[model samples]
Target: MTAADGVAATVDLNGNFPASPPGSRSKKMVRDGPQPPADPTAVGVKKSGVLWADLDPCDEGRAPTVNGGHADTASGANGANGANGANGANGHHAGHDDGAPDGVPAASDRIDGVLEMLETHPESRVLVLYTGGTIGMVRDQSGALAPLRNRLASRLRSSPTFHDQEYAKRRFGDSDTGPLILPVSSEGRRVLYTIREYDPLLDSSCMGIEDWVRIATDIKAHYEQYDGFLVLHGTDTLAYTSSALSFMLENLGKSVIVTGSQIPLWELRSDGRDNLLVSLLLAGCYVIPEVTVMFGARLLRGNRTVKVSADSLRAFDSPNFPPLATIGINIDVDYRLLHRPKATEPFKVHCKMGSNVGVLRIFPNIPTTAIQSFLAPPLKGAVLQTYGAGNIPGNRVDLLEALREAADRGVILVNCTQCTHGRVAEVYAMGKVLWDIGVVAGADMTPEAALSKLSYVLSKDEWDLATKKEMLRCSLRGELTAPARVLADWDDLDAVVRALGAKPSQTASLLVPAVTCAAAARRGAGPLQAVIDAGADPAAATMEGRTPLHVAAYEGNLEAVRLLLRHGAGVHAKDRFGRTPLVDAVQMDRHEVIAALRGSGAHLGAANPALGDKLCSVAAVGDVQRLESYRLAGTDLCQRDTCGRTPLHVAAQMGRSAAALFLVSSGVDVAAKDLSGLTPAELASAAGHHALANALRSRRSNFCT
Candidate 1:
């Protein structure tokens, strides 16, 4: 059997046919000379001439036949059989050849079959760009495996496991095209995809900035034609390509999935089939918007991924981030984790990627000369993989001097963590040394992300060094975690809060103290202590006589309340309405705040004539312990407030699940009508708490029981 026949026979085809001599294999033609770099700024080994292959007609027109049906007279006959198919004797049966040449199938019959497969209108369309990878690798005459353009699409077309014939015919009626439509039924939605193999397929190791730019440009060229895109790339530098693409494509509103496999698709137990199938499904059905890597049943942010294994099928991981979606019996996407595109923003490609970046992994007893040489001229930026939390050797003054010299020469250095997880924190003494010397903290950015981001940042020639440095620290396309803001002083804190557009306090005289105290309370002990030490009164009261302790308790700031109590703040201090800190805590349903206050000797205020108000406050806080205490103290749970709202009404309106459940369990009236003549369920529904509304409805039946 010819090699092509050998390769084709390994696939599980659905129909049966008499085997014939294999057709001619497409010649792998190498392009003439090295192609000029696509991006002017791209600096790397120039790619060789494009590998060219004739388009395989089988991919676009092959049709599945039933039983021992006659082969399409238009298409060529089946290639010679090799060993039995992977599915044993039931292995894909080939159609019987008509009155055609020994190895050639009739073209007219093939066209008729193709037309039949084109019956169904696609629900969704994905453009798969097969750049080149192990997924398409085939053994050459020398028996060495190498990527053969058009081979991947051919294998997928011939495989019944991938292109289910019976499922397609049942779902989609006879059409103009053969069963060429690849369908992925996910979440009850079917996705149809087409593959466009790149001419001169690339080995990912040879991929550079220009290739990334080319891919981005291709997507831009076809952005409006398809719903999403899938890139078949080599695994070696797949992460780098994905990372680069993440930066290159800005405001991408559709999924761009990069996937590959360790084993070739022709292998009996290859991962390529699943990877390709999943990538196609994700690209066609999901709106991930960002470039992502879908592999081993996990969809990760493209820029966040790193190839962690060379031999395992689960070869990639996002060390510092979680997978955006996990594939199981169902595709479970974390919608909250997805980055939604702004409606006002249009998708655009930023193809100008700078390639003059390098990575320097520091090691024990590493020499200063090596660092200087690596950071020499032409290298615009470098990712410095440092020790834990971005620390370097403190004793290595020479190495520090080398880094300082590089920084002085305008070489931007990004300090990234050597560890897979955690971030580069400037806590260690050596870490501070790097920070002081102008190294931009890479935060939790993966090495792939850092390197690509640096290249992207440096490509912006119009921006000043300071701006580039700032952008490096900032998260442009969800590549890195932005560092937490550390307020320098109270003024800085106030400025930030004001920027949030909070309304100013109404009482001018008490406004400053009240706002300051409230802000401190929200920030917990650190800022609260700073404010107190800065001469702000711990006992300072608002116009409503609400002190810092009351605000702290209402915010559930246990540490802030403790700090206030330790600073001689009054435990029984009452607000303008005669509400103590404990009352405020109860009103907010802050159990921890109440526990802290109760531990500090704070007591529930004396029984007021407004006993209904106290009960509602207790219910609003959802503190069952506090509610029990009030019940034991003879406060009626069924008491109605001035508005005739019961504790249950308040709990429902607040959407306090815990309190509502507690009230229901205590047999409080679930049918109790509020001031508005609405039951707890109605009140919850009106408040847009559907889950709580349902719960209340369920409990109402229990109450009847």
Candidate 2:
């Protein structure tokens, strides 16, 4: 017998195709309180509305069929593990009686025999995440395709290319609603995939942060249970979703391939058939340990991908980065390009992503107020799409100042280029000005990756501003490639590195600073050294995190700071918080460390927020020795907290007469008033430190005289 006929023999088709797919829901997708009677051909006797076909069991020693026939009560394939019609949104018929025996179930119910996630199997088991898209679409009453539910599953089950009836019958008997196992491939690979369709399928253009989080969270929930995942998504926002997933699922060790088609699967010549077919193989038959986009004939790094055409079959590409794999006559995976996570490291999925970030594309004569308002409050970060090579108009001083103010306010602004296929370089004067004003060069990242990475960085409550800025510029995933031209925008070390990359007349030490700030955020000598030795730009090094120099100074790693400095790390490098190593050193009065950084030509960070936190804390606790140390470090001794309480204000309020004496003797404002309009002496009086209040008032009067 032919394969098609052999496959058709397992189930019964009565030529009674429904106006809609069986188990289809209404436009609202609302569940009915009381369901309708059963359709005779459906595997579930209780399933109502309409039936595409009836699934039957084998002969005497086998399972039963649901076609006005006796039940295979011993096998019980359709008894509990049968088709459900609760979603049969078509209301019940008045007089049409469904043909069923007296003891058979007549009300709609869900199939209760789902495969467990933790179930063991030798074959590759994939969770087919059927989110609403072209691949899972069907024609409604108006002949317009919309996101479908069980129809795609039904199509796969009915197609011999997708399911092996004999194999499934031997394995799961008459329960066709369980895992849909595919026929063995020529390479001896068989895939067992289960469909987990999303309720009220989402459209391609409507996906957002919360939707991306939902997809990632689902993958995490079934992470250990499945070998891989295949996401059927709409084509429009597919790239954004993929890029967002790449950031949301950190340290991922399994494959997450997002795929969709231009034409709906319900169409006669649908591209979704091939897209879904190949995506399934890539997800289940291979091990690519990173989030990826699989479409047309290429598998690309998720963060590096961009949609190339709106209607072409070959729709996506990783313009800057090469495809991880190519599928033509044979699937050719570039094994070297795959991200290999350490086996010992547990995979973590970041569920929380801040949504305060936005994208701003720069154009000629764009209003300064426009950018100011766009980058204003509620926007903590932004992806600035600039002119070629990351340039801003040098003549727009107002624009420059507005951006500078935003950066100063701790808004992370990442600079990405407007071109489709090149890295952002700081070759122009204005580009350098952007770097100087604290705009992070986004290198070659797509706008999707840049914005998502920005949100991810800002959501990290533990990382300081310095760390966030450093991370925004670095490669956390394979999203961007920092070209050598970026060196010119950095310090002396990077300029030298940039020149050396051209094989200049003279050569400096190959040991210029490189590596993500997140990796060696604590030490400059260990992880930073290792990555630098492996040819990382010590100054530009990042692993989707902060710079090593930023971290070394923040953690008071005196020797690490020295190590980085001795190796030509940028002494003037600022963290996302705009604090230079010198500023961090001055914050804690790291005397010898400050001297070392200053000796290396480091300057104080401007408008730095790490200004007076340490001073206030020490003064509040009456740590006289620490206060003395800050005075020697050249601290202004006048920095205020959020409430406008200066160090002297804190000292007076805490009633530390000794601390107050040190501050007043250091030429501090003895009569400094707080936000409450209460002077230092008044604060001391209010707190019942009457003796200290008198002493402070005497000191203030002496100063006035």
Best of the candidates, TM-score: 2
Q: Residue 327, candidate 2: how far off, in angstroms? A: 0.3
Q: Write the per-residue lDDT of candidate 2 for residues 1-705, one digit (tens) a residue.
A: 111011001111232211221122221011111121121111111011111111000001111222224221111111122211111122121222223347543222111111111011124567888888877778889988776556788888988878887666544445666677777654344577888888878897888988888899899887745657989899889999899898888657567999988888758888887787788787766657678998888898999988889878888889899899998888887644655432222356887899999999999999998999998898899999999999989999999999999999989999999999898888889899999999999999999899889888899999999999888877777788743322222244556656556443212223333333544555446766665565554444232123466666656677676666655555533332223455556545567766666555444311111234335556656767667656554456776532344667657756778998888887777776544455677766655577988898888522310
Residue-level lDDT of model 1, residues 503-572, one tens digit each, is 2332222344665566646766888887666655566666455678877876778888778766656554
Query: Measured by TM-score, how close is model 1 to the native structure?
Result: 0.51
Clashes of 2: 22
List the candidate 2 regions with Cα displacement exceeding 4 Å: 1-122, 342-344, 482-705
Q: What is the C-alpha local distance difference test score of each model?
A: 0.64, 0.62
Question: How do the predictions measure up, each by TM-score?
Answer: 0.51, 0.54
